[model samples]
Target: MAAVRAGWRRGRIELRQSFTNRPELFSHFLWPVLMLVALFFLRHRDFGSTGLLLGTFALPGILGMNAAMGMVSMSQQLTADREDGTLLRAKATPNGMLGYLVGKVVSVAGGLLADLAILLIPALLIVDNLALGSFGGWFTLLWVLALGMVATLPIGAVLGSVFTTARSQGLLQLPVLGLIAISGVFYPITALPDWLEWIGQVFPIYWMGLGMRSALLPDSTVVVEIGDSWRHLETVGVLGVWAVAGLLVAPVVLRRMARRESGSKVAERRERALRRVA
Candidate 1:
């Protein structure tokens, strides 16, 4: 209980710092601004014969994509912390690693919400046909967001533990982008080939996007989904599986990574970085 409270407080402090820090603050705005620009251009375009504006079709999917990207953020931060000896420091102190992990979850989740709002608010104005005014809409949104985080964030921690360097983390982006392309974020998954659709469905991204669309899009939008149904049961089943698996595996991976950390390793990593710079 004490550790959890300390972790929560640490996370809040870090989150506050991120907003105050100039470079981090700029990063927070950059992607949302770019997305808004894309949505602005797409606002008037119709999606096939459905008569729904392309922007409206894409908005909720973008939100899901953003939510899923929390994994990437978690991975990157973990790798950076390892490089800089933050993880080492945590490992040295009693219950410190637990606190660190808690802080990270709080900060990352909070940041994701802020980023979503940054895009969603402007998006609401740009796009029409959303059903967010309903209590059911808000309720679905909450659960999907919560479940999506649980499904993705631990997998991210595992990935971060696997890749020990900032440079190595760069390699993660290509596969992620590929996943996004197939995940139906910017377009309907039904429009893709059967194999591609199956592949997309295997990952959390597709379900996240589907969940968001289910929450926000009108009932008529079901035509573009598989079987012309929301498949809420399937969404819950898949994301729940992921959430359980990630929770089980993440601690093992993180503990292993933590075990390998030492002052010597941190010094060696810094030296390698300095040499690369030189």
Candidate 2:
């Protein structure tokens, strides 16, 4: 209980810091601005014979991709905190690692939702034929967003634990970019080759995007989806399995990583970083 309270407070402070920090503020807005520009160009383009504008079809998928990217932010933050001695300090206190991790989840999740609002509000104004007005639509959107977060964030923690350094964390970007390309964030998966479609389905990003599309897009737009239907059951199943796998794996990995943190290790890292800068 004390740990939770401390974690909540820590998360609030970090979230506030992100808004006040100039570099952080710029990064927060950068992705959303890029997405809006892409949607602007796609606004008039139609998708096949479905009569759906490409931008409208693409918006929900973008939201899902944004939600999934929260994992990357979380992973990167963990690496930063570790390098800066934050994790070392956490280890020195009772139940502090627990507090630290809880705080991280709160901060990352909160930031991601804020970014989503920044994109979504402007998007709703510009995009047409969205189904946001209906109660069922909103419900579906909410659950899919929630589940997508659950499915990705812990896997990100595992990645952070494994990589152990910011440079190594940067290496993860290429694979993530490749996955996004195949996941159909900017286009339809059905248009891809069969083998590529199979590879995309194995990852959580595709299902997250598909789930978001099902919620926001008109029913007629399902024609572009594989099997000519929105695979809600498959979305739940795949994300659920991922959520379970991540939950099982993350704790052990995080606990092991946390156990290895020390003041000396952090100081050594800081010196190495300074040497590189010099």
**Cα lDDT of model 1 by residue, 200-227, tens digit:** 9999999998989999899998888899
In model 1, how large is the Cα lDDT of residue 73?
95
TM-score of each prediction: 0.96, 0.93
What's the true lDDT of residue 276 in model 1?
Answer: 100
Error of 1 at 6 (Å): 1.9
Candidate 2 lDDT by residue in tens digits, 156-202: 88888777679778787778878988998667799899999999999
RMSD of each: 1.3, 1.7
- Kindly report which residue stretches of model 1 are placed more than 4 angstroms away from their true locations once superposed: none
Query: What clash pairs does model 1 have?
Result: none
Clashes of each: 0, 0
Residue 21 lDDT (model 2):
98
